[model samples]
Target: MGERAYNFGAGPAMMPDAVIERVAREWQDFRGEGYSAMELGHRSEHFADILARAKADLRALLDVPESHHILFLHGGATPHFAMVPLNLAQPGESADYIHTGYWSDKAMAEASALVNVRIAASAADSEFDRVPDRAGWQLDPAAAYVHICSNETIGGVEYDGDPDTGNVPLVADMSSNILSRPIDVARYGLIYAGAQKNIGPAGLAIVIVRDDLLERVRAGVPSVMKYARHVEWDSMYNTPAAFAIWVAGLVFEHVRKAGGVTEMARISVEKAQKIYAAIDASSLYINRIQPASRSRMNVPFFLREPRLEQRFLDGARRRGLLNLKGHRATGGMRASLYNAMPLAGAQALADYMTEFERKNG
Candidate 1:
């Protein structure tokens, strides 16, 4: 049998081998139901149980408070960029945004069309190498919410702790680091993430909106984009993503049995530290983000000699290390150490980085 290669893609990244194996066993005849999970009716009692269990397990995993409703929506995190303002703010009202990197920029661009998007703080002058200090942020007291990308997948900068927004709602797009560690759910008004990273496959987005925030949906917003409508229907206002939800349920179960997010964080810290230590020791590579702000999930580093980039990637692929390329906007290398990435995988990559430097640099 061929071995599975370590995957380091930023999104739709990787899944636990146990989860993948369980899917194989259920693919043709799911739990003796005589049909594939993909073909099950979303409204059927069978699927209802699946949906309910998924929600229960996720809530247990994250310690999601009863005040926040979790909704499984269709589009990825991009849709929430617009939905956040549409549901939370009135026409012409301001919403504060913390500009950290590429994903943060995209969120503001879409939100600008819906409300008076305000750049409360930005790290643009540093080329997004670090998140702006929260104390320097010029927040709007009248703003609907304060937005921040908890983890900048492209630049590899992540907030170590949630910023205090005082009375204003603190909204975060946690697409890249949602389940990697434990979080204080009561601290935020809303949190949304695309399922492709730590949750499941490509077809779902998870929205955790505080119940009171649902009552703030602006007039004339479509039911599809309205948070309250989905909350009323329990994420089944329309058909839910049945297959993805099923898989996510298994993932939630797997993570819970694996000691939940607390254990995941310990392992994540070790994995990222291995790679970052290798980069720091080598003169041939560099990661520009400030050390304190560096991400434990995505490690984006660069080879000192740009000419050797292609050769480095080619050599890594030969060793069963895959998807090491960085985002196209910024050319270099990125290694996403999601929850599924084993510590051995990170150690392997770190070892390769050292050997590659010895040979080429």
Candidate 2:
């Protein structure tokens, strides 16, 4: 276990070691039950207890209000791109979107196919290195909702705080950064995230939607896609991702035992600061995003000599730092500082970067 390399991939990223160990121990039989969690019937009392506990732990960790319903749904955040407009926005009604980076653009493209999409603000002009100011957002007062990708994994941009949308409900795709910090759940009408980065695994998505917004589902929308149906059925309208939910449940408990989101946020900031300081001091590496908009979760940096990228990756891997390569579309490297990544891991990467620059610069 100690020999494992530090993982920094964008999604399906690192999880708490405690959570992994617990899963491994219970993989064959959960809590001495006759069957594995995956094999247990979803309707069985045992599995129902698991589901209830997971939801409760998550709610406590996030301090979710009773007014919001937490649904452990099947599809990842991508599917919600269509489901959002399908359930919330009418065919002709527009939904305002703030396009920050790759994921946000994909979200808008998917929503556009279902309903009218208004680009309220975009940072494409800056190659997605920054988030546009809230003051410049051109929101439609009549739009059903205002959507934003709270954190951009590929572009390394993040909103420092929630954007004010007045009466329009705020819907955020918080896939990469959810649970990494303390967020005000009340400020968002809906917050959806794939349980890969900071949650648990890849097959599940956690959706926190305000109860009142569930009444807006468009006619003819599939029962499975409707948030109301999920809430009514307790996220079990169909067979849920039992194994993933079990693991996420363990993670939620782990977070709570480890001092919750406030502690997670403190460590996340420290990790990002350590790595970003190294990048700032080195002439060989450069982070393109402006300081204000830079993401504390994903730090995308570039090598001064593009040809040295492979060498850098190789060196980092040999040094037990893994997945430091950036997204292919943008090139260079990215270090995703998720909640499960310890401060020691970030410091190790920072140290490696400094030594690499000294040897290669």
Candidate 3:
């Protein structure tokens, strides 16, 4: 196999080389079945086993309580933006959302169309560089659920810890940082993540809904959008994303074998630190987000001289540093240091930044 560049693209992002190799090895003949994994039958026993193993590995790894059901939804985390309000709250009922960054704002924007979305707390006043302090949150006790994006992929801001939303169901869109650390599943009312970030491939979202919330589905909600129905159908409400789920299963197993989330967290912190250190130490580079709120997964920084942005990116590409461009919504440079990125990848990025700064600063 020839060398592969480190993929820092946010979604459809870098996957563990081992998982990619395993997929390649099995793509044509899944376990000697002689059928391509893409051709896998969702209802077949083979897929059942694959799904069960993925769920089990994820459950065991995260210690998801018996009170929750893990769902492998077809759309990436987006559909849940609408499905969540529809399933969790009655039409026109209010739900509290903490506006943190681009994705969180998107969630609020989507939910506002379906429900009375209340901004319990927001950092927009600060330009979305950090999470609104939890102390200032004015939560609605009667709201259906309190939603937060544990890690904002675009703005590169992340929560330092699980928030205490007393008595309210805390729902989080952990799309960018789900498996990067261990979470107390019991603390959340529901947790959903699109697979493009820390999990497997894109187009799949994981939903861990507390069992009791199943009965609360507002009447008239479509069967497909209803959580209870999906739970009863065992994530088979519609034709599942078989290939993505299968690949996700392999990724889950790979994560488990690599010492699970604790180890992933350890490595993630170090990798992020390596890159952030480079930015903080340089005068020409800048990360405006507060230190405590900086993300451990996506690190976005800007060059002091915007004119050199393209030149820096071009140089980075020539060095095999791919996808360092920031989200189009926020113009700058972003390096998504997901679990698949090796320590060497982070070091290489830091080294390149240093060399670039020394030459251009």
Better of 2 and 3 by lDDT: 3
- C-alpha TM-scores of all predictions: 0.98, 0.98, 0.98
Compared with the true structure, what per-residue lDDT tens digits does model 3 show for residues 33-125?
A: 999988999988999999999999999989999999999998799998988898888887899999998898899999998899999999999
What tens digits encode model 1's per-residue C-alpha lDDT throughout 233-349? 998888888899989989999999999999999999999999999999999999999998999999999999999999999999999999999999998999999999989899999
- Name model 2 segments beyond 4 Å from true: none
**Would you list the C-alpha lDDT of every candidate in the order shown?**
0.93, 0.91, 0.92
- For model 2, residues 74-186, the per-residue Cα lDDT tens digits are 97888899999988888899999999989999999999988899999999898888999999999999999999999999989998887779889999999988887888889
lDDT (0-100) at residue 177 of candidate 2?
A: 86
Residue 313 lDDT in candidate 2: 96
The residue-level lDDT of candidate 2 at 359 comes to 94
Clashes of each: 0, 1, 0
Q: Look at candidate 1 and give me any clashing residue pairs.
A: none
Candidate ranking under lDDT, highest first, comes to 1, 3, 2
